[model samples]
Target: MNPSHPATASRHTATKTILFVVLAVALLVSVLVSAGTGQLGIPPQEVLGSLLHRVGIDWLPLPTHPTGDQTLWAIRFPRVAMAALVGAGLAVAGLIMQAIFGNPLAEPGVIGISSGAAVGAGLAIVFGLTVFGEWTTAVFAFVAGLAATLIVYAMSRAEGKTEVVTLVLTGIAVNAIAGAAIALLTFLGDTQSREQIVFWQLGSLAGSRWSQVLIVAPVIAIGLIVAYAVARKLDLLSLGERNARHLGVNVEALRIGMIFIVALLTGAAVAFAGIIAFVGLVIPHLMRMILGPAHLPLVTASALGGALLLTLADLGARTIVPMADMPIGMLTALVGGPFFFWLLRRTRKRAGGWG
Candidate 1:
């Protein structure tokens, strides 16, 4: 039950505010640091100055370095923006999945969408298809991801309802199939195609452009807006399916809408950034653990946490090896694997294991 006492209500509100402020500040700091820490090494002051200058708040001077403005506008800004958008989109997508499924373990990556998108991307690379010009891979990923989600949703439904265990199992099977498809594509490809496929599967933001960011942004924004609009319904959902229905929520409609939203968000993220793992899974779960089960604040907190994480990770990916780029999926997995184990232990201990 929600805390209705004035003191308890006030406390919850205060905590939510503090969390929002902290995460927002952290995300801002991470973005600035990432912008400044690249090869040309513009200082944070210069990064801020450049941004302010661009926006017509030109009190501060631009970067002193000759190529600073060019690099920031041409390269760093777009990549940083993409990372933030992808991170927030994936995190919110995971939140919706976990909410609808009532399963902490649910995420786009774990539930086969990411792998399905990978299959599409592999096919595009191996066959050298460019039906949509620069958008071929992204379009293919989105379509395949939507198809995979539909397949999982259709196959998992039994007695007009999707059981938690059944949905997860179906997802695993689908992921396995997608994995094999990727492998076959890899085998068919020559050296260049194989290398492209491998790097794409690994995930990176090395060459992000403003055009790609513009394409991804609107899709993610639509998903987030829809998710936020249904936050209260999701809170009812967390109470249980029967309870949600009793409270006048159209549980079926909500589930279907959120599933599509998840596919949309996942497609946008993976289309340009490739299959980044666990931003969706870890961020939502962590925020829920910290902020209680309130969906309104949880959604925003998770978005900020995810944005901060990916922004920093992108920075690390660039600087960790001096000049070589690192795969984002590997770094996120390194962090998420340990957290997932801990989450399992905590959940089991708290609930006496899953029902």
Candidate 2:
């Protein structure tokens, strides 16, 4: 139950505000730390100097030597930024999913959106299609994501109502179908295309560049803004759609709009990062546990928390093995999958309704 006393609510709000501030600092620190820890071992000071210089902070001293400066600029910087953006996008998408479904466990992967995106990307690779020119991957991903969500919505809605149980079931079914399609594409692909499909499925940031960062970062920002604007409606809908309607919220339209936003953000993230797992599932819950359940604070906290989680995870992926690069997505799953299992075990007795 929500705390009703004004003093209690204010206290909770204060705590959330502090969390937001701390998370922001942590994200900055993580990015800087990640920038220094890559191959060639750029010194922290040089990383900072190089980054500031590149960003037009002319007052900052330039690095004395070029080796660490090049490492920071050409390699580590792009990877860290990509990880952070992908993390923030997935986290925002997860928050929206949980809000719309009123279920804390609802995430893109659980509901098949990620799998659908992978299938789309996989097919694009297999067929050598690039219809959107330079942005073809992102475009195809958005289409596949939208299609998957629509299929879930149609299957779950009947008599002008959505059944949460049916939605979960339908998502599982769709995810399985999409997985089969991905497998088929992989089998039919030639050796080169097959390697591309494999890497995309595993999810790596090996070849991250500034251009890919630019392509995805805008979509993430726009989607989060849309989600934030409807934050109150999401809170209302959580109380139940009938109550939301009574309170002057347009439940159907809001739900549809939120779903589309989720698709757009999730699609963009997957398109660029290639099926990173559990980011959406883990980050929002951590944020909510720190902040209260209020949508505004929850969403805000989740965005930062997600960015931090992904950025840190990427750092580990790079640093954990000296000679080899690990898939950032795999790192997330390695960490998030165990947490997910524990969450399910902890909540099994309650069996809360799906959001």
Candidate 3:
């Protein structure tokens, strides 16, 4: 088939529309179902009712259980909200990185932003630091993550250009150092703190609260807004840096700005959600495969896809083991690990081996 055939165009369009509809519907259903699921098990009606009631709809019936309202407000809702936010943020960050770098595999974690965020958040947890009060962990994570990005940018620059290979290797080196730091902090921390660090590194949304939600929501929102605003530029950048520059794009400024946004989104997310990896790495590629490389659709579809994936993953984490809340990160890693290997092989094949 000719690549530019009208039938092919219409098929891709049809597929994108179907994917958008499916993802949106799935996300809505997942959120509602997850709200009703748990130890107490509220019905879906009550979940929808509670949502509408909060917005002043009194006709729908609420949960009958004595503690249902409290559980929904305090525990279930916050966890689900965090899962959606963190997943969407990471996926958008991943898409942004890939767009700016012009590499299908580019991701926040690939450049050590997640590891840096982990190190910063680990410091806050172990030391019980709260200088920024509720924002301490997030602030620290952003700073350190930005620092990590700077390190990669500096180390990988060769006469004003950064080679992908050098940037990735430098990021790996930074990640190793951060890992060692995390281990040292674990050793020095109290037993309680050590346990917190361990659980955090593994990633769980077990104890999320409204206050934390309030903190992370705006950070991700800001990144998403900026990312969408620059979507056209991202598309232009994909046509090669020199070409983008000739086409009136400030390639350097766009790269740096997008990198900063990635750090902000990734840092804020991992600050609260712990080290959830591969959502960033996987969602964008999957979206690209289905929706094509247009950054605008990629942004919207990737957000929905990431939110749906994480919400379902969180549901499985709690329900899969009887009376056990398996770490959410473990579940994502299960899916991502194999996908990563397959992606690596495909990427290498297309590039005719790594340069």
| Candidate 3 residue lDDT tens string, 100-149 | 76676667777788888888888998889999998898899998888888
Clashes of 1: 0
Of candidate 1, the 10-residue stretch with the lowest lDDT total is 159-168
Candidate 1: where is the Cα deviation over 4 Å?
Answer: 1-4, 154-165
Candidate 2: C-alpha lDDT: 0.83
Instruction: Give model 2's clash tally.
Output: 3
Error of 2 at 116 (Å): 0.4
lDDT of 1 at 345: 80
Q: What's the CA RMSD of model 3 in angstroms? A: 2.2
The residue-level lDDT of candidate 1 at 216 comes to 94
TM-score of 3: 0.94
After superposing candidate 3 on the true structure, give the runs of residues whose Cα lies further than 4 Å from its correct spot. 1-11, 157-162
Pairs that clash in candidate 2: 101-355, 102-355, 103-355
Clashes of each: 0, 3, 0
Error of 1 at 308 (Å): 0.6
